[model samples]
Target: MAPRFTVRYFVRAADAAEAKARALDIALEQTVEIPRDVVPKGYVEDEILGRLETLEQAPDGRPGFLATISYSEDDVGGDFLQFLNIVFGNSSIKPGLKVEDIGLSPGILSLCKGPRHGITGLRARAGIGDIPLLMSAIKPVGLSTAALARLAHDFALGGMHYVKDDHGLVDQRTAPFSERLKACVEAVGEANAKSGGRTSFVPNITGPADAILERAKEAEAAGAGAVMIAPALAGYDVARMLAADPDFSLPIVAHPAFSGANVVSPDCGFSHRAFYGVLHRLMGADAVVFPNFGGRFGFTREECRSIAEACAVEMGGPKAGVPAPGGGVNFARVPEMRAVYGKDVMYLVGGALLQEPNLIDGCRRLAEAVYA
Candidate 1:
């Protein structure tokens, strides 16, 4: 009898039935390597030492596994990234191999603080309570800094609570990150002054990995409400670093950009919820953004629900992160989205607001819908 870790796979490989049957046969008969060279050591025996059992079917009829892996604190080697890599490192490549839940021993789980600023903290900052928060994005990436700032002001005036830079809008020559950040923050402040509203302007701080923290600090100094980053693009460790920084404490929003490739395959990669939910929370994202069900993205309705559930579910931490569903959400869809996501969520709508002939009116309509 040895110590074991639990791994719950949400989606199995498309051909997992066959692969799993082979795996089971091998497990019963002899030694088996889970992900070939990725897990040189017996992954089943090493990481999941004691708890290796299979469930009948996932909610979607995908098969799943609950394995008790044997992982050593020594093997973790005192690195969080390494810990994540060791646990889900290799399986991320196999389609349908999503590590749903990691039953870390008390000692291990203790090391993970999830999110420092979660749903409640976010609500407190936004000065809203018990209602779905409405968010918007300043976009198209081609707009000048002044034009983007005007967009931010319009969204804030319209009553949106959070405004973020388009993920694709980075430090382009047309709109340098610093210029865009200053203009947007100032515009939001000006709008707030006139409207007496408290919309949050969250700029995208996805700079070179080394400069991310500096940019985050700069945004805070510029009166920005919160900041966003694509951990997969900038580096997941960078997000953790921002959260851990004592000088800048704005809420961190995690975006899913380069992450699609990680979960698109059925047999390998991390599940959408796991990447956007558990890991984002663990890395200290106050809000985690993902494509919504009805969006152009291929995420299913159940997958969207699972992501929302993961954000709000009790994990015994500061508070649950806000699940911000983005990707073509609009005002007309607010009521329906709210019904599905409920009150304790953040609704992220982009492009639509920008497309509105009257940005302020559009924002107001969205705000009204969310509040209604």
Candidate 2:
């Protein structure tokens, strides 16, 4: 047997046959020297199979792993995040750890369904190949279905390719998710029919575990183009489950709602790229939405860029996802935003556009700034 390099994931993930098959078939054996103390006592075959191997130690005292895991081709059955969950979603949250060597298995690689609709596919779908896709959101959840749908109609008519419900828009008594979803879908469709444009309506479906999937299914059934969810709000596993569900095929847009606690601690939690980038992609999000630089939330320019890079970067299976740089991106920032995000990005400008003197004109200027 030949020695091979390995990498291990630490988070709680889906440990299914596909993951196991990927590990066995894809990874090659590799020799590594782990610290004497880290390996737990009574190691069994169960532990060795789909277990994290040890390698060198980190300066921070995190035990490194000599990983022997690889993605199976069959593993491409679900969302990218789920793929990662199965690999290392749990381990990332654990206390002691360091990624050791990386092992690639042919099985998982063969099955990996790289981005089904990556930046290129998204642009094609939006009918804007040479420029970034334009997106907006309807928010302040108290609004009725008609009110939100009217906004959706205007945005679609104004040349926005995607219009999603604010992650906050849940199934409130005032504006139930289903009714709002149906109304918005119809509104966008009506606008597209007149304009002959491909406007996609993405409704927020963030809810409890029991209701989340039902909401997603309903949104899809209502002719919605995509469904949005705050994975952290519902459960990190929720996105993966929806992605894997055969009938729930609409692209999932992952939002970082309620996940602020994890990244606030620099030393304890995962790096921003690891969470917003790697983990979100693995969860099966075709497009991962995050707060952009110069936004109210205070994400730095570099951080925003990293998030964008993560969405486009090459992964084990498909091309990376669309980096939806949202949160206070405005018409004025279009030139600067375009310079950073490039044409293969999704420009999400919301509240600012709504506050503008003319919502339609503001959108046009924003689009021009990006396309120009």
Please write out the lDDT profile of model 1 over residues 1-372, one tens digit for every residue: 234334555544345475455334323222233444443446545543222366444565555543333455544544678667666665554444556665555445555666768888888877888778778888887889999999898888887888899888889988899899889988988988998888889989876657888988999998888899888888767777677777978898899988887666666666667778777887788899999887788887778788888887776553589999989787666777877888878888887877888888877777777787
Worst 10 residues of 2 by lDDT: 25-34
Report the C-alpha displacement of residue 174, candidate 1, in angstroms.
Answer: 1.5
Q: Write the per-residue lDDT of candidate 2 for residues 137-159, one digit (tens) a residue.
A: 98777988898898899899889
* Best candidate according to lDDT: 1
Off by over 4 Å in 1: 1-5, 10-60, 63-70
lDDT of 1 at 315: 69
Q: How many residue pairs clash in each candidate?
A: 23, 43
Query: Once model 1 is optimally superposed onto the true structure by TM-score, how far is the C-alpha of residue 310 displaced, in angstroms?
Result: 0.6
Off by over 4 Å in 2: 1-114
* Candidate with the greatest TM-score versus the true structure: 1
